[model samples]
Target: MKLSQLKILDAIVSSQSLKQAAEKCHKTQPALTMAMQKLEQDIGFTLIDRSGYRLKLTPAGERFYKQAKRVLSGCDELDKISSTLALGYEPSICIAYEQLAGDQRISQLFGNVIQQFPRTQFKIVGGSRFQAVEKLAKGEVDIGIGPWFDIFHASGDFQSVLLKPIDVILVASPKILANGRTTLTSDELDDIPCLTLKPTELPFDDEKLSFAKGSQVVMVEELATLRSLLLQGVGWGLAAKHVCKTELENGDLVQIRLSDDEDQFQSELRAFRSNRNFYGPVASAIWQGLQELY
Candidate 1:
């Protein structure tokens, strides 16, 4: 019937002892028992089964407790919303990123934003190319960071900037190299399987320069998974220089050079923000900070 009484019931159910519930509520046991009795009288039902040593909720009591917990949760969320609004901070913002967004750089840039606006909360979502772009176009996120392909569609309202380029080198397990040569011909590469990013959007083509276009290729959803496949000698694939630096250094994988220098591949990382969303003080700071990060 009352919010405080519901809270008491929640404490009792959670602690499983009336005395413990009284302690949690910071009240004397007798006063707590009296409040509970008054609640039951108002509701006209037995809310607890006291026949056992540990207090248990009766059938009806269980149902009431479940609804009471939801009410409490709603109350907490309302408090949070009110506090955030009072502080003049945005409720929440999401950043959708491609899996290749280097975690270290992202973290460092965000650290500066957090220092300036500690109350601002950030939600990061990472996925493959098409998925990240779609989330941004649909207004599911405020910003996006990923490899930018001209073919990926974006509306006129979206503003974008090209970040630093990420070098993508073809790599495979050293064991996969048959001739013990650092360079391989395109025809030779076409013979073995090459892990490739699965297309998720329309009018898909082998956009990036690749030698394994028509060769035995495995379509994958993420670079990390593709690296795993390459590590096991499952196939060769183009990977970001940052992601494969450790593996290449430790001899877990080796970069393959193409005999034709023209076949080199590189993708420019880009950031996008929808102009429709009002960039509040915090969002504006973040948006500007990201552009300067690159």
Candidate 2:
């Protein structure tokens, strides 16, 4: 089907009614219905079940709607790039990273994108990888930097580049450590009240906290809260060294450094995006900057 048809279909999926969808597309109800009919006939499948007062997509229709939206979004990106190129203007890139990775990762990754492409502007935000990827699917953001979360791979909406690896370490409040017990052998961490960042489903070691475990467990809402909770002496959280840099530097936090065993957990910063999304000038600039990082 045509790009306009796909966009109209996507709008119908969102508006949920013929009247609303037609209003959204600035067309009459009959014209909108004809468009839907043409699309369904071309695709050889029923796109929606019109039995309800509010429109709902059939199972096959829901699937088509998703794919169609991505195609339309890609077209929109191409239009934006073509227009910008004609006007001799540098494009903008919006980046979102898992807050768990912290600002250091963004600064190291996209910081130079700003300097290299003087005309382009970069906006960086922090959240969970899931949140970042969700925004990417909606074509709201250009690139995402974070760990390679398994769920994103499962969904097929993400492409990733692995950066540096790290361990998920359990960090205790210095208040508890002040009893001189902060110096625990690696074995003692098993029984500690660790603030886990991972969800209960990942294939993680039960006995050994990947120290990086909590990054996977942390939800969008809980990501920022974990850092504050650690500061409050609530419990130990498993996070990257960069994530807690300020606290560690200020002596408010410390890693449970293991002397006998080398930390082997391999969490890494990964750059990602949806398949249909375009990596225009702004995105390329960020990639260029990240390439120069140590």
Candidate 3:
């Protein structure tokens, strides 16, 4: 029933003699004979029959020999796989982050880690800050990337590492602008409503050049809906510059600065997960990579 017995059976079958099989297996003939007998008893079958000086395989014995060969071959394959893992330099790591940071920040971090560990694998996920952070908390994601103003204020619930500075841009359509992509004072934005995907309120320093309360801010949390509203030229919004790179490059959208804005950069990229088992190979690999990006 054991793999050892199966291998002996296979060797005996190929050698066609107990003496040769015993020598091939580095065991005495009597040991090989008893092993075969125990194997047949365990399987409830007759595996071999003695004939004068040679051996003949019974129906069950022939079947067992065929299976034994396969089993031995499989064992050999498993050993090879284990040995390769131990010897190879490559390792795999998984990560989750915003789509905006996937090709940019995430890759930048990966580049730093890969220089030291060239044969490492990283599984990347692209999602919003909310979705990515939730995954990290649930142990579904190794790292979360997003603006974590809420998480930072939550305090002591998790750990975070901050990267480069970030500032949400004021994106507007050409139709809404007379000067078109130039800077504007806050008074100019007072009459203009902003498009958003969700109902949320966050503060920004607008006293430098403009001051206003309650612009027609449209709520849109979904990317598709947000993009659609953005294309409509209905209002202006505070968004990550990287998120609209394609639109900006294609002349579909332009950034209008609030005049004399001193608090231009108010955000930073952060990576985090809930406190748990964080020292696994995956974590070590990604943290090493993401730190460079930061």
Candidate 4:
């Protein structure tokens, strides 16, 4: 019934033995046993199955513990929120980014933010293509860092700071190249399976500067999967140069060229946020820091 009793139960379930649980809870085995006994008496049911060598939760206890865990998690979040509010910062600020965002830069920015505001919780969500921008538009995230397109800027509801420009190039395994030719005609390109990011809220148009616009596309949600497929000669697709830098250098993957530079395009990576949301201290610090760091 008491939160302390629930804590004891949690420790017992997590630890290898009752003695280990006692150490984890910072209480003697007898004390922990007495607490659980009192808890069972209050609820009029046995919570632990003691007949077995290893302790196991009874059917009723399993159900009760599931609900109790939720309460404990809620309490933890409530404490974090209270502490964050007391420090005059947002409870949490989430950064949604695509694979194109350089890992080194993102890590450096994240580390700086942690050092500046240790009390604020930071969440990082990874998406592909325009999914980060879509999350920003829906207000699901406090910030988005990914490829920038004029269509995204045309909305005028978001503000962005440009980061590095990424070169998205069409690549495939060398095994698939017949006669060692890197260039593929439009008809030939369409004949090959093209790994691409799944469509987001943004409209799809062949007229837009997209690599897989006119290909036999195989949509994937993650960049790693797409890269794996390309490595296995499963398909050809466009990917950021950095994402496959090692592959290209090692000759595991070869860039497939198209006429009129349609095989590659420069995508500007930008950190953007909605203007509608009021910026808290933590969010403002992150926004400003990204601009300075990138």
Candidate 5:
């Protein structure tokens, strides 16, 4: 019933010898045995089979040991969280991001931040476009990284800092660009389907989005899915330079340069945080890390 008794029980089960369990628990063999006896009496069941040379658990004893182990694990986690809280650290920091954010850079930034705050829990959530911003505003995430233009104008509840420009070039599978043409005109794009990401919080269509004027369009929520569809020659749409770098180099896909300078594709990515004056220690560290990363 007591935590100490559970520890003794677990030690006995693991060591398979009462003598070894007592040494491991830093208690005398008699004290450990008496504790086990009291526990069995309290539970109204025998926990161990002493007839064997090596300590063995009864069928019921195995079940109780398993549950006790889980309880001990929970206690350990509770202690860790409590210790982190006492040190003025947030228990967790969640970040939600759009696919256009550079994965390699994000990985590096996160790794550095984690090393600095070893006790802080981290969660990364991915969605298309403004979804990350919505999560930040709703307090579902501590930080949001994605396109900023629309998001900046859409919400006053959050503050944002420009991180970097995401270079999105129109691209399609080689088969879709079978004509071997480097340039695509607006008229040509009308006949070809355009794969695009669907914003989780806003309308499907954004007039300001690059190539939004394409007549044939397919909307999806994840960039990975759109990439897969593009590789299948389903359509053509603007893709992050880093995301399609391998494909572009391998000739599996090729960029479609816009014929008009007026239609050049590019978007700015920014890190957004809630406007609240206080960000928990972990979240504040993450925000500063992101600022330095860009």
Candidate 6:
């Protein structure tokens, strides 16, 4: 009938005797009995079995308590949300990160930020090339972290901080370069398929990412899929160094040096948020934490 009565019933159901329940609830046994008696009278049914040595819930009591427990759990959550709101924290935040940025690093960043604001919910999503920026533009996410592109800078709608540069090296499976060639020319790769991230938007220049002028291009929606295809010798393409560090070291995938000056690629990653709307404390904390961690 009341939250206090339900709480007393919960304690009684959990304990071995009325005396124990009274001790747990910080009340006298008589007061505890009186409370339950009032509650049962209001509910129009007996809620406890008193014939046994240890008190137990009646069949009806068991059903009623099941729902009561959910109410208590929700109350606890509401209390936490109210406290968090009082401190001006966002209840939830969503972040979109480019796959090339490395998952382990992002996980570490999340771990650090979570320790600071444990009640704030976080939704992390891995995206393909330029996908993070696209999500930011569409207001689909609270924050975006990925390689800095001219388009992002030109937009002027985002506030950004530059992080460390990520190295992107051209690589291929050893089987694809079994000829023992230490370096390759664009013409040499002309016949191979280039596995690349599919463009998320139109009017984007694919030429800037092309390694071979005549190579057949395979558009992949995810980096994991592209890496798997590269491992199978399906194609040669650019990959982030950290993403393929183990494979490159084990000789499963070999870096193909281009004859031209562009064999190795490096791009700075940026953490940015939309300038259109004001962000809450949690979003601001995460954005600052990212800049510090990176």
Query: Which candidate number has the best TM-score?
Result: 4
Off by over 4 Å in 4: 1-87, 154-156, 203-210
Q: TM-score for model 6? A: 0.66
List the candidates' TM-scores in order: 0.63, 0.65, 0.51, 0.67, 0.64, 0.66
**For model 2, how does the per-residue alpha-carbon lDDT over 131-198 read when each residue is reduced to its tens digit?**
66566655678787766656566544676776666556657678756465655665555455565543
Candidate 5 per-residue lDDT, tens place, 1-294, comes to 899999899889889988899899999999999999999999999999999789899999889887887787667556645766687886677889777776687778888888888877888888876787767654567688887775365554678888878776778887976468868777777788878877455444364554657467788877788889999999987777877899999999988876864445677888888665356667777787777875
TM-score, cand. 3: 0.51
Error of 4 at 213 (Å): 5.5
- lDDT scores for all predictions? 0.77, 0.67, 0.66, 0.81, 0.78, 0.80
Candidate 3: tens digits of C-alpha lDDT, residues 111-180 = 6666766566667776652555656654455567766664443432577777655666778777788757
Model 4 accuracy (lDDT, Cα): 0.81
- lDDT winner between candidates 2 and 3: 2
**Residue-by-residue lDDT tens digits, candidate 1, 176-282:** 88976769888777887988887654335344534566577688877678878899999888778887889999999988887965445777788887665555666
Which candidate should be chosen as best, given lDDT against the real structure? 4
TM-score-better candidate, 1 vs 4: 4
Clashing pairs in 4: none
Query: Which tens-of-lDDT digit does each residue in 58-124 have in candidate 4?
Result: 9999999889876876675566557656868876788997877866866887888888887777888
TM-score winner between candidates 1 and 6 = 6
Q: After the best TM-score superposition of candidate 3, give how far the Cα of residue 241 lies from its true spot, in angstroms.
A: 2.4
